[model samples]
Target chain A: MENEPIIEVRQVNKSFGKNHVLRDFSMDVNQGENLVILGKSGSGKSVLIKCIIRLIDADSGSIKVLGNEINGLDQEPLDDLRSKIGFLFQSNALYDSMTVRQNLEFPLRIHWTKEERLKNGYSAVMEALTDVGLAHTIDMMPSELSGGMRKRIALARALILRPKVILYDEPTTGLDPVTGREISELMVSVQKKYNATSVIISHDMNCIRITSNRVIMLIEGRNYADDTFENLKKSNDPKIKEFFT
Target chain B: MNPLSTYIKESPFLKEIGEIALFTKRFFKEIAKPKQEYAEFLNQCFWIGYKSLILVGVTGFIMGLVLTIQSRPTLVEFGAESMLPSMVSVSLIREIAPVITALICAGKIGSGIGAELGSMRVTEQIDAMEVSGTNPFKYLVVTRVMAATLMLPVLSSLANAISLYGGYLGANIRGNVSWNLYWFQVFNVLNYGDVLPSLIKTFFFGFAIGIIGCYKGYYSQKGTEGVGRSATTAVIVASLLVFIIDLIAVQITDLLGLT
Candidate 1:
């Protein structure tokens, strides 16, 4: 049981009115592995992650994170659970009104006591910013940063809490190839540094290849395929082959 | 029956009312929670109160001057020209100043809060705040609502004083009335009854403006377009609610013999 999955989602079904986003979808993310959920546009990848965090409630399912059932936890426990899970939204979701330092401090302020934050908040913010190589831009607003910079800052904010599980929603969607590759490399390094389990939702094959230890193909609202990237790459099935190609 | 058409026609409006009622309930529940956002509340007071002073003052002054100027000719026909200061002060202290000042704030502060929060919602900043384990509703909505509720009465009182000053200036424009005499007349006719009802109503006005603006913004959808809609709708709804609250306040005050 020591090797039990950190995240276990079973038979999760989500629907918006008549549109079924996730149907009988189930997956398990083991400890300390980068698991990428690959899906095309409108394939409910974003919704899936949102459900994992309870940002969007599933129609019906069992979602357990760190062995706690997430579906029915009250607000206090839900927030406590969320503090241990870092989420990187597709849009970065950086507070445009706040400086990068303030953005990174937000999570700390919420989860840590004032005394604890006073002791370590400054160095923690600096450490996260330095990890992403943006320590100099701490005072700058999110609007002042470029797209890639914003993404990095967002990632830094996500990493600041040293979350046990990091969920990335489209981490490299809008960046150029070089910048995307840099982010991909950063993801790998961050994973190694923290030894954190990450569930990344992206369709970028390069990013998947660079970061994912294991990949799950999300097609037609189900876990269509699950295997190592190399093994999935060599598959003969057309649905699995389309992703590799 | 065309189910889709019927759903589109009725759902949004009915759903919106239900959502707003639920939002109001949530606001009360959250406001009672411990660990109030004192820093954010002060920041909002500075923005909603301090920042709105100039506009409210100018509008109040202009309203007083124009009302005095317009009423002068009518009063002269009745040989009641000497009653200008008293009449103007009473009208202003009782209704005009508070209503006008509230409308100005509804336009400036209400729209501002709406657009700012709407953009935050669309950008997923609200969601980020939630996921970060911070109470976005408490930090954002409660602080803003409390600031508006507390600040509008202060702004209204300031506007009333400025309007009385404007009335004196207008009175001196045509005929010479000394400042002492004008102040004497203005204060003589004003009482606790007149002032209290007007000030009491403004708190409701402020509450309506803040709640409506926050509700619009918090429930915004459809991205940038939704932001624009929230701002516009916030102003409209708040302004309308201001008038309705005024009507109810007037009736209540009348029943209590305060007016």
Candidate 2:
């Protein structure tokens, strides 16, 4: 029971018309591990997490999240399942029309009842914002904030729901080095604080090194390598070493 | 149907028509569901209705004023100068006001909806709403569409009134017609037959503008360029729809012996 896999993907295949993005790719993420999926540009890393959440339907696959098969779940149960899994998109997809407070409160608006939110919504928003060290910027719009602040607000929005598993897509792609490192550290600490499993999709080595307990390299749309960061760094395989270089 | 779709699938125009038909069907199905976004709907109403008041009013006034001035000379030639107010009121309430108002909205509200939704799609905000377990269509599309549908009739009615006042001023520009006479003649010439069909068609015009705008924006691609295209196309399609709807409404009313 202690070694149970929370998110299980078995031989998933996805294609866009003539483009075969993910071909027979498979992986298993244990209960509380931070798994970094390393892939080159155009690889099916983003598509994999999207499939896991059923945002995009796969061509063929068996994807089980929290012991429930997601490929065929009805809309009601699918939405319930989604509430338990937090997704942080690469774009930090904050609602531009909403303030930081409203952005953080969006999930609560969906998943919590009127009374439940009345009791705890404000504190939950504050706590999530404080967790990312941007509580002072709560009333501000996403446009008013800097790039890094926007990312943190997005993370706060993701964490406000207190999900069992969090999926991060390119968490540190477009930021400067200093800001990227700060976000990486914040990710690791927040993961520890929430005691939640994390699946991070990124090509940034610094982010991968700081946050991932194990690395899975996606090459040509399949599971090419799976090992600890140090072990993968020391490997002689050019396919693995090319990423390290 | 499948064979037809497959055959015309290569034609972009035909492809978009198919897409819009499917989308409109989905809108009907989704709007029937419970848990309506009332707050957002009201917000949209404010944006679509309250905000567009001045523009619609100004255009309506111009339509009435111009029609009265242009038609007065012909009436005078026939020695029917006294019928100026009645003719202007009949023409405007029956046709001109509703069509002009719908075209104005197609440019203003339609393009605005398109650009807003297109930007939301490009930024992945729509996907974010889905990832948060919220129905983006219910919140974004339905609210805006409903607002537009409800607001257009209100705007068109307001335009009709303003345009009649403009017609009064036009009638007075040359001839010395009393205010009481102008009001009496305008009302006397207008009956249920002339007004009802004109009013009925505005709802269709509103629905067309809302649906076209949302469809264009929802499926927009290619980033900023796509957003521009969506906004431009929404305006073009909605404006064309105004004329088409008016033509059909006039034909239907005539067939029913309402004219």
lDDT by residue (A72-105, candidate 2, tens digit) is: 9988888898998988889998989899999998
DockQ scores of all models, one per candidate:
0.87, 0.84
The CAPRI-style docking tier of model 2 reads high
lDDT of candidate 1 over A102-191, digit per residue (tens): 999999987899999999999999999999999999999998999999999999999999999999999999999999999999999998
lDDT per model vs. reference: 0.93, 0.93
Residue-level lDDT of model 2, residues B57-88, one tens digit each, is 99999999999999999999999999999999
Instruction: State candidate 1's TM-score.
Output: 0.97
Clashes of 2: 0
Task: Report model 2's interface C-alpha RMSD after superposition on the true interface residues.
Answer: 0.7
TM-score of each: 0.97, 0.98
The alpha-carbon deviation from the true structure for residue A54 of candidate 1, after best TM-score superposition, in angstroms, is 0.6
Query: Can you tell me the CAPRI class of model 1?
Result: high
